[model samples]
Target: MRKVLNVIALLLLIMVPLLTACGGTSTDSGTSSPGNDSGTDSSGSDSGTKKHKIGILAPAVTHGWVAAVAYNAEARAKELSNDIDYQIQTSSNAEEMTSQLDDLMTWGAEAIVAFPQWEGMEVPIQKALDAGIKVVNFDIVIDAKGVYRVSGDNEDMGIQGAKYIVDKIGKEGNVVMLEVPTSGSVSELRKKGFVDTMKEIAPDMKIETYATKFTREDGLKDFADILTSTPKIDAVYSMDDETSIGVLQAIDEAGRTDIKVVTGGGGMQEYFKMMPENENIWIESALYSPAMVKDAVDVALKLLNGESVEEVKVIPTTIVDRDNYKDFLDDNSPY
Candidate 1:
C-alpha cells in the first residue's frame, strides 16, 4: 500500500504541471487558452515583422478607361511600400467575380479594393467586412454600409455635358442621348443629371434617350438603328469614350452631315486627340479622370497606417472642349 501511494503521488505531480502548461481550466472546454501564446515576448506582445496584404479586384481591361485604371493601380501598389503586398484579380463577369473574391479572402488579404463590374455583390462585400477586413469600393457604388467609396461626381459630369449641348445648340433642336448601362450607378447618375438639366435649361429642345450597353460595338449598332428610325438628329451625347467611338463610326458610315456635335465622358487619349482636330464628329468630352485609382490606394495606405479618412471621397470632373481641351490635355498621358 505504501508503494502504491508513492506511485500515485509521483503521477499527480507530473500531470498537474502538464495540465497547467496546456491551459487546462474548468470554465473552458479546449485544452489551449484562446488568447494565450507560449511564444510571446516578456511584454506579452508579438513582433512587428508581419507585412500587410492588400487585394485589388478590377474589372477586365475591356476599354481604354479600364486599362488606364488597371495600369495606375498596379503601378501605385508597387510604389507604395516594401512591407505591403498586393494581389490583383480581373474578372470578365459577375460569376467570375464571386469566385475571385472568395480566392482573395482565402489568401488572407488584410484589406480589399474593388471596382465591381456588376451589382448583387453586397453579399460578398458583407462577408469580407464580417471577417474584419477593410473594404474600399472604387468607381462603382455597391450601396452597402461601412464601405469607403471613391469616385468623381457622376451627376456633375452629366450636368456639364448637358449644359455644353444647350450652349452649343442654343436651346431648340432634336437631341439624342447615347446612354451608358442603366444597371451601373455611374451611368444612371449621369443620365439623370443630363435629362434633368436639359429639362431645366433647354426646355424647348426635344430630347431622346437610348439605353444601351457602354461598348463600341453596341454604340455603333444602336446609333445606326436610331439614325435609320429618326429623320434628323441635331446632336449626340454619349457616356463613354468607347461608345463615342462607335457613334462616330456609325455617323461616318451614314454620311450624316446634319449632326452638329458628339460628346463623351472619360478622358480617353483617343478622344482627347480627336476632340482638338476632328471637325465632323466629336466636339467635346467631360473629364472623368481614371487617376482616381491612385487616390483610392493612397487612402487605403493611410487607413492601414492608422490614419483617418473621409468615408466618401469625391474627385472633381471637368468639361473638355475645343476651347479648354488644351489645358487638360496631356500628350504623354496614358489615358
Candidate 2:
C-alpha cells in the first residue's frame, strides 16, 4: 500500500509540470501570432490580415513645387490599396517636425518617408532608426547611412544651367547668380555644378553670386539689390523658377536690356509658356520636375513586397529651351 501511494504521488507531480508547460506554451503561441504585431495591419480593414504602416514627413506647401510634392504623395498613398496604410505630416519648421515624427512613431509607423525641411534633423531620424523603422528620404537628403534617398540629379541640373547660360552669353560677359540656401543638398550641388562648369567653359565670364530664398518675393528683393549693386549684369541664372519670376520682374522694372538671358531650373508652367515666345532674352530652363513622389511610392511598395531597391535612386533631369520646350510641356501636368 505504501509503494502504491508513492507511485500515485509521483504520477501527480509529473502531470502538474506537464500541465503548466502546456499552459505557458499556449500563452506564448497566442501572443506570437501574425495579427498581433503592431503596424502589421496598417490597412485597418479586415481583422487578422497583415498590413504595413508608412509615414511621410514633408515640408509645408509654401511654394508651387512643394505643393505639388504634397499633392502627389497623398494621392499615391491612397491609390496603393488596402495592404498598405500611410500617414502624411507636414511641418514648416524644425520643432513642429520633431513633434510630428514622435506622434507617428507612437502610432506604430513601420516605415518613414521624410523630406527634412531644414538641417539638424539627423537626431530624430536616428531615433526612428533605433526603433527599427525603415526610412526613405525623399527629394531632400540628410547625412544618414542605411537610409534610402530618392532625388533628382541636382549637380547635372546645375551643369545644364551653366551650359545654357554660357551658350547664350558667349565666352565673356558679366553673369549674375541667384542663389538659394546652402543647407539644402539639392541647392548646394546645383550651385557647385553651375560654378564649376562656368569656370571650365567660360573662363573669361565674371560670375556674381547673390543670396536669395526659394520664394518669388525674396527673389525679387534680392535681384533688385543686385541691380543696384552691379551696373553691367549681362545674364542672370536663377536657381529656381520662382526666383526667375522675381528676376524677370526686377529686370523688367529696371529696364535692364543688358541682361541677355534668364535661365532657371524646374518646369514651371509660366516658364514653359515664356520659353517659346521670349526669343530676344533667350529664356531657357533645366527640367527638375516634381514627379519624384510617384517614384518614391513605387519603391516603397516594392520594398514592402519583399523586393530590393538601390540605396540612392536618382531621377534623370533634362534641359528645356525653346527648341525642345514642346517635348517637356504637358498641358495637363501639375508642375
What shift in Å separates residue 192 of candidate 2 from its native position after superposition? 0.8
List of clashing residue pairs for candidate 2: 40-51
Write candidate 1's Cα lDDT for 232-315 as tens digits.
988987888778888888988998888888888888777777776767544788888888888887777777778999988998
Q: Cα lDDT of all candidates, in order?
A: 0.80, 0.79
Model 1: worst 10 consecutive residues (lDDT sum)? 30-39
- lDDT, candidate 1, equals 0.80
Q: How close to the true structure is residue 305 of candidate 1, measured as C-alpha lDDT?
A: 74
Runs off by more than 4 Å, candidate 2: 1-48
lDDT for position 5 in model 1: 100
TM-score per candidate, chains pooled: 0.82, 0.83
lDDT of 2 by residue, 1-335 (tens): 99999999999999998988877832121212222343333333334655577788888888888888878887787776345667889999888889998998997878788888698888998889888888888877787766787888889988888888877778899988877874488788889999999889998889888788877898889898889889998888787888888888888898878888888887888777877775668787778777787778777767767788998899887878788887876777666
| lDDT (C-alpha) at residue 36 in model 2 | 36
Model 2: lowest-lDDT 10 consecutive positions? 26-35
